[model samples]
Target: MSHPQAKVHRMFEFVEAIGTLAFSEMPNEEFLALGMRNYWDGYFAGRAAPLGLAPAEVVHAVFYNFADGEVARHIPWVWGKTTPAEAIAVRERGSAAALRQLIGDLADSPGLVRVADLATRAAVSAPIEGRVLYAGLRALDVPEEPVARIWHAATLLREHRGDGHNAALVAHGIGGTEAHVLFALALGMRAEEFGRVQHLPKAQLAAVVDGLRGRGLVDAAGGFTAAGRETRERIEALTDELAAPAYDVLSADELDELITGLEPIAAAASTVDD
Candidate 1:
């Protein structure tokens, strides 16, 4: 089978390569100028841990990806292969602009929130999901790219919720449809109630309900099942991960302030998935 984790491998590889720059035998001034210092030190070395590479490898990954243009460049090896001195060379102030663009380009960026509404619930509830997700990323020992897909999937679910409360539901077979229909058939509306609230035609609704029942995420009565429970756990975990760094850096009140910023994101993350 194709590797499901290819994106993770690539992302980690990015970190691994960029982290190496710190040890480049270049001038200390040149190294510092690149903005390659404490970033990796704090992330990979901190709670993220040695994920099959040493501290330096992670930094090298970012530098190489930027030089090669695997990500944002939408091009191939933009910088080509250059000696460490050539790569880090700086002759004029223009170098500053170049460095800034380079940093912005290479950043994992457009964080999930940027691409879509992150959390829909109270920003605090959503952060719980972000914090868990980051933890999952750490546990996976992969880069954030693959894990991002999961978050993107969650964002889709939130959008699905209010409109049919499933604007983004990918037919996950749970009550969420968007949120993986987290609660079971029992928790979901009853058959007659569905008749009243459902946006789908009667025939289509029956089919959809049948599909959910077959999947074991729901029952005839629309109660939750073990599989459905797992889906919620996964979403909850991801949200927690996204919010953890803020939680760590900010005081409780400060964290609340940050959550306020994340509200839009939480809404976006709950999308309907396929």
Candidate 2:
């Protein structure tokens, strides 16, 4: 579970992807380019520093995400007035080798990892969004081995609204895949629409559904069979091991500002803007 550098773990990628997806509100393409993976790399490494994480461990933790396209390209760009080039020689090549050398050097740098980790933790944890997500993950026990395997897989699909992929949690699970296909089917889409949303080949999609049917997960009507319903129930149980947050705390004034723009689309509101 300690895959500071885990894209290679396959299972890690699935779970990590899920954790990432459940947290994002942006579209897939935008999230993909957000440098989130690198941000995490910097984050975990910093923890391993003065907080008790060694610089070497930080490097490894981050390295794993880099392979998942989470880190994507290891390059530098402008950050307001600060460029990575100003302090880190690793930016010179923008390659994994470059990243390694730089991180390797920082392994011995005084107070650097501490600073990075603190900054990252501050930025990530301060958000309302971050609070909700951590609350959820901090509550999980992975249910069963099949779920643990595909949790990340579910994340992969969840993160992107359009980009082609499935959640990481199910990447290696036959039963997981079976559940996934039925879940999608139940959501209601024609073959063409389903084709557009599916991350796998059409045949693969059919096969997953077929496998579920073969195992009696679906009935003759193509809905969940008793066995399939049990699977669905299990997945749902895992999802709610903790209470989901309620978003009803908005004040009349605050809610007014939030929904004011959509008043035209909705009904007229008595709460007017200042």
Candidate 3:
């Protein structure tokens, strides 16, 4: 019997690899500065250009994932000397450069080829459900390395999930910060302690919570009200529905196979620096 949950788990390995490799070290000033100088832009238009969205729309959409206050706080420090457009142009170059350096410095592990092969298999199996994500990733010009290919496939999958998640948030009328706060609450995280990883200001979080409480979605103590839990579940269900297309391309057994094949590589990569 094939299990859909297996596909989700399998796909997560690829997703985790990208997160570890590309984003985990983002808070490190040197890495953050480099990325801000090349990829991320604080300005609406600059950030919106590569995404092909209106600046205003992009600003709203970005907050769904990054939270506005955090982006504002970090941008000045990350790319003080660079313009948004300039940063966009060099984003890929910088990523590739970093990959080259990482690969050079690390011991030549056999996992590279294994992970790349698994990623390619998943990419080929990806269906039209991920069409937008696939197209966006395909447009990236990067070196022909196993690591690069894995990163590309992982990014496509990640964006596919993100696009769906964003749609769900909009559909539910959840403001960006409130959504994060509610989600953290739903997961049993203390709201006051949430900003450590998300980098949101305590005041910004409080304001969002106040609004949520006003709507009866949150309690005064920063816990989720009954309605809030339902809202969170609905949002997750819708997001999963939207992200289902790509996984639908593979058989349960095939996904399991992919997952099994990538396990060693995932373990190895996780030990590497972000």
Candidate 4:
């Protein structure tokens, strides 16, 4: 049988999709109307809003994936364009609108209302120690609207999981670039693609890959060796284990209901155009 935590990790993706769609699909005009220069400006500002104008270094440390310079380029400067409150409003509004567009009447159905309630309980009950981003999000007031409430709760859970994942990576001594390379190899994606998407310099990417190879985590052909795969698996398992605490507040039946209720909504959200 799969680890119980694995189920929570896997099933949470459907709710994650809703938040991802909201962030990526929010219209350009909406951002522009807020005096934000571009998508990145809005994205950085909106995501970091909960921290109340945090420094670029803080965002880089918490986000734990993007290159430091990439984060420095947007934050603080993005705050100059709009206040944290305004950015949060845009994010929540966009999330609600995206859910409505994707799931239609299902956005307000009894099933979703239950999900909002259950997810909120899990989110709020999550322990705050060492979960900086999740704690920041927890400080925000829950949205009154059903769709927004669900989105907000999902986002909280996502960040809670993300913080745990970062801790797992750190414990394994994997740096940010190395983490990307390992994940790409795990997904069978080309290393170059991750480099391009993350804007990592070619030399830096090659060096990280070389380091992985030296450690026997990667083969000469740029794929995970047996040990490498095992390492990645361990990291993921630990991440699930860390993320499990949030859902501990729910009963078995409530957890099942949360997962089942999200199934159709996640399926519908998946149909969105790429």
Best by lDDT: 4
Q: What's the lDDT for residue 150 in model 1?
A: 26
TM-score ranking from best candidate downward:
4, 3, 2, 1
RMSD of each: 18.5, 17.3, 5.1, 2.2
lDDT of 4 by residue, 88-123 (tens): 888888767877788888976767778888878988
Which segments of model 4 are wrong by more than 4 Å? 1-3, 27-29, 195-198
Question: What is candidate 2's lDDT per residue for 1-55, written digit by digit as tens?
Answer: 1111111122222223333322222222222343434443333222112212223
TM-score, per-candidate, Cα-based: 0.27, 0.31, 0.69, 0.94
* Candidate 2 Cα misplacement greater than 4 A, ranges: 1-176, 190-199, 242-274
Residue-level lDDT for 58 in candidate 4: 90
After superposing candidate 1 on the true structure, give the runs of residues whose Cα lies further than 4 Å from its correct spot: 1-188, 191-197, 243-249, 256-274
Better of 1 and 4 by lDDT: 4
Model 3 per-residue lDDT tens digits across residues 80-184: 454544544444334334444455533245666665665665555545442443454445553356656665566567666666777788888986667668768
Show pairs that collide, candidate 4.
none
* Residue 22 error, candidate 4, Å: 3.5
Candidate with more favorable, higher TM-score: 1 or 3: 3
- Candidate 1, residue 223: Cα displacement in angstroms equals 1.8
- For every model in order, what is the number of clashing pairs? 82, 27, 1, 0
Note the residue pairs that clash in candidate 3.
Answer: 38-87
Better of 1 and 3 by lDDT: 3
